[model samples]
Target: MAQIGIYGLGTMGSALALNMAEHGFDVAVTNRESDWIAPFISEAGDLAARLHPYTTLAEFIAALTPPRVILFMIPSGAPMDAMIDEITPLLAPGDTVIDGGNADFHDTRRRTAQLAERDLHFVGMGVSGGESGARHGPSMMLGGSAHSWQQLKPVLTAIAARYEGAPCVAHLGPDGAGHFVKTVHNGIEYVDMQVIAEIYSLLRNGAALAPTEIGALFADWDRGPLKSYLVEITARLLSYTDPETGHPMVDVIKDAAGQKGTGRWTVIEALRMGQSASMIEAAVGARGWSSEKATRQRAETILGGAVGAFDGTPEVLAEAFLAARILAYAQGFRILASASEEYEWSLDPATIARIWRAGCIIRSALLDDIAAAFDQHLPQGQLILAPQIAQTLARCIPSLRQVVCSAMHGGHPVPALSAGLSWYDSMRLGHGSANIIQAQRDMFGHHGFERLGRSGRHHGPWWD
Candidate 1:
């Protein structure tokens, strides 16, 4: 195994460093604080003897067995830039730096080029499954050229979440692609969680069920095809107790949710790429606005409406929620696919789905369906609309349609997922869904729309 150095001996870095050593790699750990990874290494192995801790970048580089490979687990943007500036000066030609942070893709691209001048390889890696997965095995995404990737593949594969004998890891295509995919992963997670939250609210408020009973209902769902990490989380959310009152925490549960910017970046990037990514963006915004209860309540009083009333049995509501959730996934996958293509990223949709199946927040049985769907379509994302997924969507469509209608009729925000699905469902299986682009030109530029029968263009205003 190759000797390696890992910077930032925080929760993820420390655990990952030990795992690397256990996997037979001569792993050197680094942090500004020299003692950071020491305790963790001591607990896991004879780290004071086995793991070398470096206090500075120059010292770390000079000590490295050459063709130096260092894994960075630091904050993105500024701090990363500062550290790289220090290390780039010391690194020998052919050395590699792997970024395992939630960095912006464009930034990754810039960094790759900056390092290339000195023959130093840079890889933007997206490592998922948090602290625990890194210590055990986490799903990993890599992006760079074949030459650069070959150097790190062995180490990454050994420390990744795997199924059968295959590592649940892949080298995404050139420059910044891994982080791009990971950004979309987080966005999908936002929508996935939002949909689950909506389901919980609908069940608790509309169905009037207790938290434990609700947890039981979610647990039942977990046993079926909908089995997933989100479902597991649904149970946890209900089981948590109020620290103050010892009451069922669900009743007094605060509506406010927190985010750490991945979801927001996904939306902004989607807009830059001209893709429709409203559902997840709306979810992020919802979390932000949810924190302001006083504003929400006062606005509701003045506006006279907010939450909708959608009456249905638990099964009926669950089906509706599931349908909408599927649509959200549908849009998310399409956006990711488009981004991959635009970047020339040879992203294996099947591998991506499988990697997502274990460690990430969006891990769901739906991933199995997605993997199969991609295999059936190969090089196509329309599989979500294919016969099998179509059937599943059809089974849940009635409820999903009802939920959207109810939410809309009652002045609630349904956002991108349901909105996209509703729009998709409205267009019958045929070409020309209202000639929207042509209509836009007619409305704004007075560019006459062509008539079906005659070759002449119609110049009359569309509305007036």
Candidate 2:
């Protein structure tokens, strides 16, 4: 009998199955439709020997050994719930069902509870690294029953991305923890992409530099402290030439940005939990606004203004970009801290940072530093407040301020950068202007405010 059964032979599922097969694990595979199996087998080549293909779900389930591990790379939300419902009756007490999808954490929690009643183990897993990562290795975040994790650990650890001989997979906490962490991972990715795009805009519009020049500059930055996959790919993207048009491929591509919902979910969760994640929120907004190309084009024709030339060097701008990037991570991890408390996940921020270092889209050299900081220090409520991180910001923030100022005068929109600065300033301010606002609130609606140096609430009589 196969050690694991992988249902749903989509791109992700097939890659995972291939990975396991290549690793000499006997894997059973099935799909919602039968036509995909032949193509999958054809792609598998010699590795197909270890793959047991099944045409039906029942057959697929039966092919696995007792106390089987059945993994689903299906659609999230209602479809995921439906799949679990369908499989519950067929699963034995010790059998485990793992959902390796971009599922909402709440749904994962509910499903974990629902499966527990049937004595079935459910793992809400967050798998990252895209298709190539799945085939080679991917970071896996597993959360649910500890017993289930113990049973599945060997198989998952063997297949997960390794950094310095350690697998990127981690058993986070219970129920929804894995998916919640993944959601934040995606949110940070959104900010990283947007900030990079904003820097590109600054270079293009303000510096009047060509894509090739910008690409070369990005390549240089990748060798420095700002090194990351996003920056690496962006350098490649900027340098890519369209064969047909003999022009830059990035220039020919559509200006409109697209989103996959996880970014929005991160912002939503942050707001509900009363944590500030302005950088991520700004990035999501930038994408939303980018989708309004028609409106922007029309407005551009009607309204135009000259912008001053860029007054900063590529190196200086790189420092500024790094500052904004750190702020974005600050916002993301802070939200996670709040959520961890609210959900009682006992999340290890350092562990989360370590897992993200290898296989996730947001993988960066900076994560190693982040992991070390979290591991060595107590919770300061914000990653930015950590001593070393604070020193880094101190070094970089002046450049960030200059970049934001230059961008404003240079007429390039750097929403994420602006948000990062705003968040930093607000966080550090000893006295904010909210007192007058509170007075106005109390005057109009009798909303009470505590007087300074006292504990009791007081209402204002503004008319008097």
Q: What's the number of clashes in each of the models?
A: 0, 0
lDDT of 1: 0.77
> What are the lDDT figures for the candidates, one per model?
0.77, 0.90
Error of 2 at 189 (Å): 0.3
Measured by TM-score, the strongest candidate is 2
Error of 2 at 41 (Å): 1.2
- TM per candidate: 0.90, 0.97
On the 0 to 100 scale, the lDDT of residue 215 in model 1 is 92
Off by over 4 Å in 2: 305-307, 461-464
Looking at model 1, which ten-residue stretch has the lowest summed lDDT?
420-429
Q: Model 1: C-alpha RMSD to truth?
A: 3.1
Highest lDDT scorer: 2
